[model samples]
Target chain A: MRRYLRIWRIFFTHSLIQDLEYRLNWWLNAFNTLLFLGSSALVLWVVFTQADAIGGWTFDQALTLLGVYLLIEGVTVVFLVPNLNRVPQYVRKGELDYLLLKPIAARFIVSTRYASVWWVPQLGLALAVILVGMARQGTLTAGHLGLLALMLVAAIGTLYAVWFALTTTAFWFVKVDNVSELFTAFFAAGRFPVSAYPGWVRALLTFVVPVAFLTTVPAEAAAGTLTWGWALAAVGVAALLLALSQALWRYALANYTSASS
Target chain B: MRWRPRASLGDVIRVDGLRKVYRVHEKEAGLRGSIRAFVDRRYRDVVAVDDVTFGVAPGEVVGFLGPNGAGKTTTLKVLSGLLHPSGGTVRVAGFEPRRREGAFLRGITLVMGQKQQLSWDLAAVDSFLVNQAVYEIPDAVYRERLGELTEMLSLDGLLRKQVRKLSLGERMKCELAAALLHRPDVLFLDEPTIGLDVTMQQQVRRFVADYNARHGATVVLTSHYMADVTALARRILVIDHGRLVFDGDLSALVEARAPEKRLRLSLSERVDRADLAALGRVHAAEGLEIELGVPRADVARVAAAALARLPVVDVAIEDVPVEDIVADLFAQGRAARAADAVRAAHEAGAAAGGRG
Candidate 1:
């Protein structure tokens, strides 16, 4: 465990040094975060102008849900997206063998290899947005913080599991970027709470796209109305997905043909 | 069919009946076939690295020679644990390579000429640092090895430069440094000097030799350049059509595959093709220069006869080139392989009929 951590730390430093070579990314990412926030805020204002409440949740509740969505997006963009998406290129180019030959686990090497640190500012702002929403609802209980912590873990783990499971399919279909893009489109639904959508859309988001576990659970945790049952269920489903992805990764390695030299 | 007995005690690497089969998706040549194939995908087994068995004792350097797609790279991959074998077992440094245990991986390294492990966007130094951590090299040891490699590979300025920005030779030098940072006991280098300038190739050769001498590391290398094999390897293993066709000393391989010597003669006058052929098999004849291939046993008689009959100004006898010998080995295998396939088909038919 310590050895893997050391490798991740080294990778983090390597990424920082590499990012320094492209100094313009800081400004570009800042601009990108603002663009995302502006569009989401515009949609929220447009939706609330028509309805006073969205599926029984007031405007502040929906705002917090959007904030949670952005938070997940920020974390994914920072660490997971850039790295997971490169799995296909590595498989196609046969560069994964180098990673496989490493002393550490290949999954660990690929997962934590790249980081876009420029998104840290937006991550902080997303946290502030969640806190502000909680304050407005006057739900500042210690129990709420504990529930939020557990839900956040489940949310992040589930996101990684889905993305990684999709990415690992590259071993069989070397070009699945189109399917990954579809997953991204589904992830956009996380910007709105599942309850705001109709019943069928709620089921699709909860089961098919997993946006509910990603956004709604954490938003409910911040809402102080979250139940222990919901938190445990999210954690259970996330654990199952993580184990499946890990098993798939192992099976993929065993059958890897390693693109000919 | 095995020549050398398996070295069970002292060998750093061992393989017994190693085989790897690839189920390649067959693609069709036309639109109709492509659609049919897409509708119902079919695959065929490609037996790469078929029943190959070999061993390398501690600190031994063996040159693996084979034609393109003759399974040299596949065997190397299996040895390095990148590809698991369909049949047989491989052990390197007393551990199974397929398991790829941390200790086993730390004990071996594979360097492919066309591929690199360096982070392209970062300086080479950053990738080296990554390797250091991944390999769990102590800080003091990492610094010591870095200094040694930087000096050996002439990587003083190259370390800080982005891998993408460096020249091919420069990148290769840094790559070698990265691969050797862990100082693995078993090194599997496939075409390590490919696409390098002559000077760079020579430097790489010398660096490999020096590293081997200092650390006594086992090296298995494959290259198109016979000079590399001749200069470094004491023994050579030749693979053709996914089989080990020849395994012995380099001199023995040349002597066994080529039973003739090259005789180059410069005559006082232009000679007839018939007269040159009379001396021996005419390899080349232009104006006053005539090259002949005479039986190794008859070289003395052929030289004596040529001197007495022709106005010989100069004559030199030499061994056939290793490249020609290896090429001839592969060429011979192609013909023999067709006959073997036919015989195997006949045997299969006969067995089926008998069973019926």
Candidate 2:
């Protein structure tokens, strides 16, 4: 575990240096990330102002959920999304060949290779919003905070599995870049609680996309509304998904043609 | 581990009837196949490797030679475990390469000229350090290897500079250093010196040779450049059209295929074109200087007799180059391939016509 962390740090530092090369692009992208955050906050503010509560919580509760949603989105953008985007390029250019030859796990390398420094500020801002919302609500329990921390870690792990499985389709389908984009579009619905929608819509969000676990379920734990059974279920589901995705990645790697012409 | 059977160098690397076949999606140029592909895809089997078998004793430097699409890289990929073989067996350092266990991957390295492993935007030193951690090499060993490679490749100031800012040769040197940080026991170099100046090319060749000699490491290299092979490889493996055509000593292949001798002349005056043509084919000519090809049997007599009669300024006899020999082999291979293609087509057409 320590060795893996060391490798991850090295990889992160390497990606940081690479990203810093285009200083102008970084600044422009940083501003763009800010715009995305501003728009998200504005939309949430307007939605809460029009209603006393969204689904079953007060304005502060909805704000906290929105804050967690932004934080999750920002985390994915900073690390997972960019690395997933590289998967198909690796296939097309045969760069995956080198990655596979390494002693470490190929999935680990591909999942964390590229880091987007522009998303850092947005993540910080999202965390700040969560903190501010918590302070305003007061009456925060230690157990609730602990559960939120566990759910946060579990959310990141589950997201890794989801991204890995989607990107590994590059092994079979040469042009799946648009498919990944469509997946992100579908996942955008997770910003709201599943209970806010009708029964069939809630079922679709739960079974088809599983976006509820990414946002509402984690936010529920932070808001002291999560059941212990659901918390165990979330951890169990994340472990299963992580295992399944890694198995799929290995299988796809075995079937890889490596851009032969 | 110490109580296990101690295997010798002879069994270091062995391959038996290895094969790889790729299912490639076939699409026509027009919009019709594209539309059809969206609904129903068509695929054909491309046999990238067909029963290629060979072995390298430990510490032997072997050159894998082939044309662009002749499966040299595919074979290396299989041996390195980047791609699973469709059939047959491969063992390197007594481990299955496809398993890609830490022990197996630690024993070898593959360098491809077209793809870079270095962090393109960072200083070369940072990339090397990253490699050091990943390969888990001790700091002292990393420093020593880096120092030696930097000195041998003349990468003094290039290490501190960003990889993007370096020239092609400079970047290639940094890449070599990164690849060599752990000092792998088996090296697979694919076009390592593809694009470099003459001096840089020689430097790389020397470095490879010295590294192999010092560590007694097994090395297999694939390249289109015959100069790289001739200077470093004693044994050559030639593959064509996804099959092994020849695998033997370099000198033997040259002697058998390139038997003709070259006669170079710096004449005192311009000789008649007809006269030059009569002796042998004029390989090259410029002003009073000329290079001619002559059969081995007639080379000595032709040179001696020509010098006696004409005002010969300078005359020399040398063997034909290895590049020409490989070219001759490739031409012969292509003709044979064309013939096979025609026969296959004819048989297919006949069968279809008969069925109709």
Candidate 3:
């Protein structure tokens, strides 16, 4: 495990250096990330102006939920998206052969290979938003902060497992480039409170795709509204999905015929 | 560096009845076929490797020669644990390749000429560091190995340059360095010198030979460039139609497939084409130059006859090239298969006639 972490660290450092090499592109990417967050915040401001409360939450609560969404998006962009997006290409080009030959697990290598450290600033922006929203709501307590941190970790784990499982299908369906787009489409629903959606849509977001756990439940923890049952369920779901995704990754690898065969 | 296999071991790599069949989707080439395929998909099984078996002794460099789709890459992939074999078994360095244990991976590396393991945007050294961590090499060993590899491949400034910015040959050298950072005892190189200039090709060939000589590593290389095979591999394995058609020393393969040498004579005067033919099989005849294909056993007699008959100024006897010999070997394999089919048909006809 330590060896794998060391490998990930090396890969991450390489990505950081590579990103820094393109100074102009690096700044441009940073600008674009801020532009995206600014635009999203603008949308949130307009929505709150139109209504005082969204789905039983005040303006600060909705902003906190948006912050959670941004945080998850930042993590996904930093680690999961960049790596998973390359799976189809790797499968088509047979470049995955090198990963398979490595002494470490292929999944671990592929998932952590090309981290987008350029997104680090975006993650910092998300943290700023979360802190500001918490400060505005006057809900910044130690207990709430601890719970929020735990739920955030669980959410990130669940999100990574979901992305991994989706990308693992690339071994069989080599042209599944749109799979991440599908995830993004569902993730957009997490920008608002899960309670804002109708019953069936809420259930779909909560259980089927679990975008609620990624955003709304973590936001609830931040708001000091999360129940013990839901927090326990979040941890259990994260563990279950992680194991499932790992198993699926193995099964997909077994079916890998490798390119040029 | 930690564990060296005894040199007296019979074979570092062994295979038995290995086979890999790929199920490829077969789609017809039209709008109608595409529409129909959307509703019902069809697949065809391609036999990439068929009951192929070969072995390589310790410290030996074996060349794998095959036409495209003849299973050279597939066999290498299977042997390197990239793809699982559909049938039979493969053992490399006394470990089943499919198992892909840490020790097994630590002992072997596969380099594909068309594919690269280096990170495109980073310096080659960064990728090397990644490999260092993946292979779990000690810091001291990693630095020592990197220093030696840098010196050997002349990768002084190249390590700091981004891989995408490097020249093809430079990138290839770095690829070799990255794959060798662990100093694996077994190397599987598939077209390691493809798309290289003659100089770079020679350099790569020399590097492979030098690395093998230094480390006593068992190397299996596949290449379209016979120069690579001739310069590095003494024993060549030729695969045709997913089967090992020829496996022997380079000279032995040449002798088996083409048991004749070319006798080129720059005659003092123009010699008749018929006279050249009478001497041996006339390969080419120009104004004052004559070339004859003489049987290996009759080379002396043919040369003596040629000198006695024609006014020969200079004579030279050269063996057939390894490329032509391999092409002829493939042709012979095809002819033999065709003959077998014909014989089978004739026997079936005879049996049916006898029953009738």
Q: What TM-score does the predicted chain A of each candidate obtain versus native chain A? A: 0.93, 0.91, 0.94
Which sequence of candidate numbers ranks them by lDDT, best first? Answer: 3, 1, 2
Which candidate number would show the highest DockQ if scored against the true structure?
3
The residue pairs in collision within model 3 are none
Candidate 1 local lDDT, A1-261, one digit each (tens): 888888788788777776777668777887888788878878888999999988888888888887888899889888998799899998999999899899878898889999877777789878887888788888867988788878988999999998999999998888988866887899988888788899999998998878899999999998976788888899999999999999999888776744343
lDDT, candidate 1, B125-197, per-residue tens: 8898889878888999999999999888888888888899999989988999999999998999999999999
* Fnat for each predicted structure, in order: 0.77, 0.64, 0.85
Model 1 chain B: ten consecutive residues of lowest lDDT: B1-10
Q: How accurate is chain B of model 1, given as a TM-score from 0 to 1?
A: 0.93
Arrange candidates, best TM-score first. 1, 3, 2
Error of 2 at B290 (Å): 4.1
Chain A (candidate 3) TM-score to true chain A = 0.94
Q: Which stretches of candidate 1 lie over 4 Å from their true place?
A: A257-261, B1-3, B6-8, B297-301, B304-309, B341-356
> What's the candidate order when arranged by decreasing DockQ?
3, 1, 2
TM-score versus the correct structure, for each prediction: 0.94, 0.90, 0.93
